[model samples]
Target: MGVDQNSIWNLHNKLPSFPTLNKNEQTEVLIVGGGITGLLTAYELINIGLKVMVIDASTLCSGTTGRTTAKISAQHGILYDSIIQSSGVEQARQYYTAAMDGKDRILNILEELKMDIDIEQKDSVIYTEYDENIQAIEDEFRAYDTLNIPGKYTETTELPVETKAAVTMFHQAQFDPLLYIKQIIDVSIKQGLEVYEHTQAIDIEHGNEIKVTTDKGHEIHCTYVVQATHFPFFDPLGMFTTRLIPERSFIYAGKNENPHLKGMHLSNDTPARSIRTAKINNEHAILIGGEGYVVGKNKSSADPYKQLKQTAYTLFPDHTFISQWSAQDYNTMDSIPYIGRLKNKYENIFVATGFKKWGMTTSATAAVLIKDLIQKRQNPNENLFSPSRFELTSSVPTFVKQNSHVATQLIKGKVSDEGKSIDELKANDATTLFKKGKKLGVYKDEQEVVHVVDTTCTHLGCEVEWNTYDLTWDCPCHGSRYTYTGKVIEGPAKKHLKKEEL
Candidate 1:
């Protein structure tokens, strides 16, 4: 399984199964995911003596949180300047302050709970080797100055790679997120915060008390429900799918012979690259991530993993990568995350999504804002990140363009045909093939077992494509994913694909 189990965080933090929702339950709040956001939300709510139940389709931290680079920082890649230009200076400052507050919240929790994890404080650097991008870097520095953010504009970095310009944000941090979260799980359980695995929240019936129905046919009636799943699967608002687009990126980890870098580095370039170091098996290994593209729109004829592997080789010569994995993220139309009440009419329902790739800080911030909303308190960042706050001028064109692209992909998927006959397919490979004039997703295991399912996505009609690296059927439309055997893994799609006989 070459780069299949790519994230080192997942390798170290395998969790045991918790109970599933077999009967109806009631709570003050029902959190619909067990990743960092859900767990953190539950922890916060439970601290205030509210009865909270957190459920996941899988185990805790098994989603995108387990697959993250684990960089906790305010330097979200030339973001402040863009926010200032679009939303304004006060909003940008609030964004910066919220990010720092997020980092501090994590530390405060760890200290209060006495949780031991491999967390380190380091600077975060946003750099670019391209000369053309220097003005953007300068503009970001100016934004930093206006916001009074603790950062310095630098000419060089501790990165082994050469650079044209860099912005260093001071005292940022990195850690093994799962390990820390595991401790949170233990404390949360002890504090009467209920957790259920293998329990997928299928749909929510909004009322005075929201009723969340799970895949297992159990109901969780709660005063409030938080959609912490990476993509807001049950978008009662009918606007989340349109407001955000899913992005996929790759990460390669290997031992480096050079001196370990002191800072987390991200490139401000077209095809972005991020560098950070981690301790693996008692030795330091470098993690190089970033080759982002719209999900299912990987137009490059070359495999993305191969390209990232080559990048790792160039950056760390003679270093053999132990693991490589890919993760998916969603970017909002206006760039800022939506992290509050789902809609005005439905006050009991809330959502936290569109964190771009900066989930560590954003998710933490979201937890506080969500808690405040439920507790009936004022949060300074509420207006900036309100789920209903739509920026018509900037976001409308982007919303139309993204949806148009989705429409184009939907048509392209239906019309395009590039598949092999069952007899021609090699072992341990997956492809979209026509079987008896029907488009089907085909996967052949190493033991020569064949699995076939309808290539059409269950969420929307956009045809699903075979992801060779992760061995799943991915949708270009809304980022829903399915296993080769037609089981729904991620959603936006509540139902599994229709299975087909080979």
Candidate 2:
């Protein structure tokens, strides 16, 4: 079943909003998003005595950062093995080191500020669901050894389900992402960083001085512009449409026997599950996450909540279900993020994106990398994630598949026939209806109230599928999900679908 407003993260709190840009503005540096990436960049720039301005399409931290699982770790599940094989031993080692260093930097900041945000040092484990991948897990262990990172290979895991093998990393961590972001924003503001929420950058005029034009007709003139808006809004460098594919991941929070796992954990196999624990006030909660796929690629099932519930029950039947939410992330083709300059063509314009599913650490790393680039300092990981590094042959298949799906949706026939009445919907079920040639998706909650919204997704105008597990309308093409009331629950859709009058 879909979660109501009782989410622990959403408890007793309203997000901070900043006024939209209304006129031409000037700053030394202009950042285009207010999430972790943008906020951190702004904060770092301000601390370095550079004037920085951050603009967001909505309230700060309301985007992907707010919905994140909030795990702060260098152990991006089963990635070290793949990185070592795909890139090289040195590149993999550097990546892991950079991530760990970033995690330490965040912890240092939290300690400096004396903020208590449920920060805990936990071990991170990567396990395989089936025995067929035992050798692969072993290979990953060997790769970790090459990096001198201590990881133990074991058959016993913390999950209630059985696993063949697992590799565990010690001293990893997780925290409440929203609290961390809010603290940073407050500090940045004190340091004279200008922030404008609900301000959307519509176009950019790149030259000696980059001019950012917002949807409200306001222009920001800056010597440097950072495209930290999850996906860069401009394609002058042709990055907005390529190099990365957006994907969706779901997470649910419930009370369980604490699993007492030493650290956060994830599974390497399909239907991946990420496990962690959090505290709401004084009570502990378990967060189980998995069931992710490339957007629009799968619609075989209307809901996966039952599967999550079953997993929780099987793992720790003694716990209770509390809060649940899902998040969407962008994945790059080569399994690495694209940071540094926008491209060779645009020297002053910078971009930070394509963190795959490890944004919490990668985004911080991006801030460090971009800050170094802006200050003309040497950063070790710059070439590793440079935007110009093109391995086209490896990415072409995914690019073709994703764009082909988008093209098909653009020209596909619309459902012009009227569909079922609102009264026909049952609690916790949703149906797509066409009324007078306008397509609508209606969902009835546990309270038997119907919330209607346009079935069309704001991103690329694709038809959205009903996600019963989260009780939201999901777009298959770009992984955009929205609440039944038409509020965008996830992105790369910044705008909400138009709500239908009930």
lDDT of 1 by residue, 276-389 (tens): 888754677778898888897787666777877887887778787778888888999988899998766687788899998999998889999999999899999899898888
Global CA lDDT of candidate 2, please? Answer: 0.78
Error of 1 at 171 (Å): 1.4
TM-score of each: 0.95, 0.88
lDDT agreement with native, every candidate: 0.85, 0.78
Q: Report the lDDT tens digits of candidate 2 across residue range 27-106.
A: 99999988889988887788899999999887787667777787888887777877777777998899998898788878
Worst window of 10 by summed lDDT in candidate 2: 410-419
CA shift of 54, model 1, Å: 0.7
Q: After superposition, how far is residue 391 of candidate 1 from its true place, in Å?
A: 1.4
Q: Pick the candidate with the highest lDDT.
A: 1
